[model samples]
Target: MNKLSLTRRAFVTSASAFGLVGASGLALPYYSRANQRPAFTHGVQSGDVDATSGMVWTRTDRPARVMYEVSTTESFADAVRLAPLDTSPASDYTVKRLLTDLAADQDIFYRMTAADLSDINAVSEPIVGRFRTAPASKRDVRFAWSGDTAGQGWGIDETGMKIYSTIAKHTPDFFLHSGDTIYADGAMKDEVDLPGGGKWKNVVMIDGKRKVAETLDEYRDQWKYNMMDKHVLALSAICPTFYQWDDHEVVNNWSDSKDLTTDNRYTEKSIPVLAARAARAFHE
Candidate 1:
């Protein structure tokens, strides 16, 4: 592969950053295109397990590489770098590493730092999760299902909070996000940069200005934004999440052959049908 070089000035110009700052006081850029300096972006994920190995995934939306450290403790005071990984926009600015020879049924701690600089603030909040290795056999798993989190960007709403609380008390192993997890196209206060609320409007994008989302990236961003809610984040951390999609996951109502401008007749029926499909995907 070829390496791309970029200057710091040209980099921050396109970081397209977001998210709250931590005690570290770093400008964490959540996403960016190629040729931009990654504004302190990272994510921690664990999956694909066997007895002795599992995968650790992280990414950066910046123009440079990132180094990751995995450990068995939150402080990473005793952690070790499995290896250095290159980051780029092609993989959504992330990397997946296969860590081998780890003990089964034990918790592991993981954190990521950029390749060029060490910013403790940029480090993730110590993602410590257990390694299950593999299921012994077919077994019953209990979890909760909720959706239709229709609200604006940047949050959890009253109804959404209540449902999440209900799930917590039930104490299922995990939760299934059945569908309609976010109203990406719905207008809200944040949508119009108002103080409180805004009404739903057709997804729009203006030239030289931010556009209302009507594409896959916009829909994904809606999910990320919604999950930022403290309540939502707590629930996610407490339990594994199974997710699916609905029209609102991408638009208000859509189907295989219908456009956003399609008639209401098609929308009314297709929405449910597409909703079912999204649910099934979540299940699978």
Candidate 2:
């Protein structure tokens, strides 16, 4: 990929930059791309960070070659560009890489821009995320961990997942997702009445979360639905997350000895087959 001649500020602030920023200096989610240019579907993510390396990830709307650069400064005055990577149907258009040779105990800013493989000249608006590499010497370290998201019909509501926003407030170096990265087996209704007079409502109802996941695409949608929450997206943008899974990633109390014959919610009655599809979505 050619070195980006345009500065980050000039690129994002440009009038044709797809309204990445408005007069309020804040950006909009799912910013309209009526022109159908390739887009970064989900927000950027980083994880598995160490003293000198970290993993950065993102996904595109279509097959594209994503180019990225790393810098110690947000302005990218001293950026280190890496070889571009191509996203395809096999990987669900998601791309991630391990960034090595980074300075320890320093802020690392990573930026990504994708060019549609079908239309190489049509590029995407650049997206940026930051993470601090581990310290080379003895020093203080901070982090966060979470699990069981949108479980038991407690989906994202109008207030959003406030816990994620609370966790981001501390600006942890990274986050550990202990398990249940997604509640694929927990089908959520539009709303559930509380024990008292209040109502717990799902601000957005996705078809994937409406039933237990059985197909590969449905499992993928389960993950996407969780990221739809504003708080979840905000935390992921700047904080790296190391993921682990639990039974809920496939089904409640799932195991080799488990049987799905009694459960008719899934058309695929084989637990192994269901687990395979869920595993692929989780990995992606």
Best by lDDT: 2
- Model 1 agreement with the true structure over 112-162: per-residue lDDT tens digits: 455322322243223443333333455665567887764544334333455
What tens-digit string does per-residue lDDT give for candidate 2 at 1-284? 22323344433334224323356766434433547678998888888898888999899999988887787888998776666788999988988888876777888889998877776656788999999888889977899998988889999888999999999999998899999988888889998999978889998878989988888988998988888888988998888899998999988877646766677754355677889999898878
Error of 1 at 65 (Å): 3.7
* Pairs clashing within candidate 2: none
TM-score of 2: 0.84
lDDT for each candidate structure:
0.47, 0.82
- For candidate 2, the per-residue lDDT at 53 reads 83
Give candidate 2 misplaced runs (Cα > 4 Å).
1-34, 256-261, 264-269
* TM-score versus the correct structure, for each prediction: 0.50, 0.84
